[model samples]
Target: MIEEIPSEPVVITHIIHETPSIRTFEFSRRFEAQAGQFCMVWVPGVDEIPMAFSAGNAITVQKVGEATGALFSLTEGDVIGIKGPLGNGFSPEGRVLAVAGGVGAAPLRPLVTYGQADTFILGARTAEELLYAGELAGKAEDLRIATDDGTRGHHGFVTALLEEADPASYDTICVCGPEMMMKAVLGILDAHGVADRGQFSLHRYMKCGVGICGSCCFDSSGLRVCRDGPVFTGDVLLRSSEFGRYSRDAAGRRIPF
Candidate 1:
């Protein structure tokens, strides 16, 4: 039987800086989360943001804005609220190549930790900005790295690295990153005729983690991202016009594309 877990406010106990602009928050939760699932983290006085789980069963947050910045300022036992292990995550059932760009590495970490038939390709703009390299390198079968400034392993975009790889060697590909990067990867997958077999995590600015808010809705299928996915198959991704576009926040104001 599937046990239903209730969402509630919890206290944050720790914070770690994964990079200059990125930090990870450690929060206590009893619920078990799948690899790519995310949670809506609520700051008492600020807005709640959807963050992906990095460590299993723990909420790891990267400092990006007001809520996240407030989260980073918190100390041990600081009170915070959380709502879910929301959205679909990566399911690496076959030979998989997991690709992560910038902070995108966080959500994909769990799959690398527990799932099988996986390899990892991690990228950042610089060596200092690269997160989870050591951990992913240890867990993944084959690990590759790329940076925009030539400060790390390969000097180029991760998509360039993907283009050079043999797509047939892997049964599936999992990707998460900036919209442009994911879109570029998707294009490469298409040219290689492997688009149908890949999975992508769509990063969007979300207000309510639940479907009712409609803050994360995409017009193409009228799909609510919070309810339908933060993760989708490449074929499904291709069908959504909103994949590369910006979405609205709770205020119904346009963010940016």
Candidate 2:
């Protein structure tokens, strides 16, 4: 039976600096979440933000927004509230291909560590921004890197690498990255007549992690990223008019991507 796990306080027991801008905070509590699932992390006296589990008991955080900045300021033994294992996750089929960009690697890390990805393509702005590259290299059967600054492997966008890949070669192609990148990847998959095999994880503004707020709902289909999915199939996303066009801000204002 799927039972709801209530919000509870968790203590940070360890911290691993994954990148200059990203850190993984480990907690004592083991959250049994799948590769694509996320949790609502509450920073006391600050804000609650949705975070994907980077590991079994850790959240890889990039120092970005206010909530994340607050999380960065924290150290070992600091307490935080966690309320999830929420939403659906990727159920890896055969011969999975995983693609990630920037911090999007956090969620896909678990999948890679599970030995799910037969091939993994990772991209970031620079070499330093590539999260878990070393670990992922040891995990995935094949690992490729792309950097915008030419500090590492391919000197271009990750989508450039995706373009070289045969989408139909893999049974499932899971992607989590910047919206524009994912959109482009989706186009590639569609052109290859394998859109059904593509799974894209979306990043949307969310106040409440649950479906009640409706803040994360996109246009047309009105799918809630928090509830329905942070991970959506390429075909479903193609049907949504707002998927790549725009997203709502915290104030419900339409922000074009």
- The model with the greatest TM-score is 2
Q: Pick the candidate with the highest lDDT.
A: 2
Clash pairs, model 2 backbone: none
Q: Give model 2's clash tally.
A: 0
Q: Can you write out model 1's per-residue Cα lDDT over 150-219, one digit (the tens) per residue?
A: 9988999998778767765778888888888898888888888888878888776676667766778776
lDDT of 1 at 204: 69
Model 2 / residue 132 / CA error / Å? 0.4
My TM-score estimates for the predictions, one after another, are 0.91, 0.96
Q: Where does the lowest 10-residue lDDT sum fall in candidate 2?
A: 1-10
| Model 1 score (lDDT) | 0.78
Candidate 2 structure quality by residue, lDDT tens digits, 7-59: 78999999999999999999989988999999999999999889998887999
Candidate RMSDs in order = 2.5, 1.6
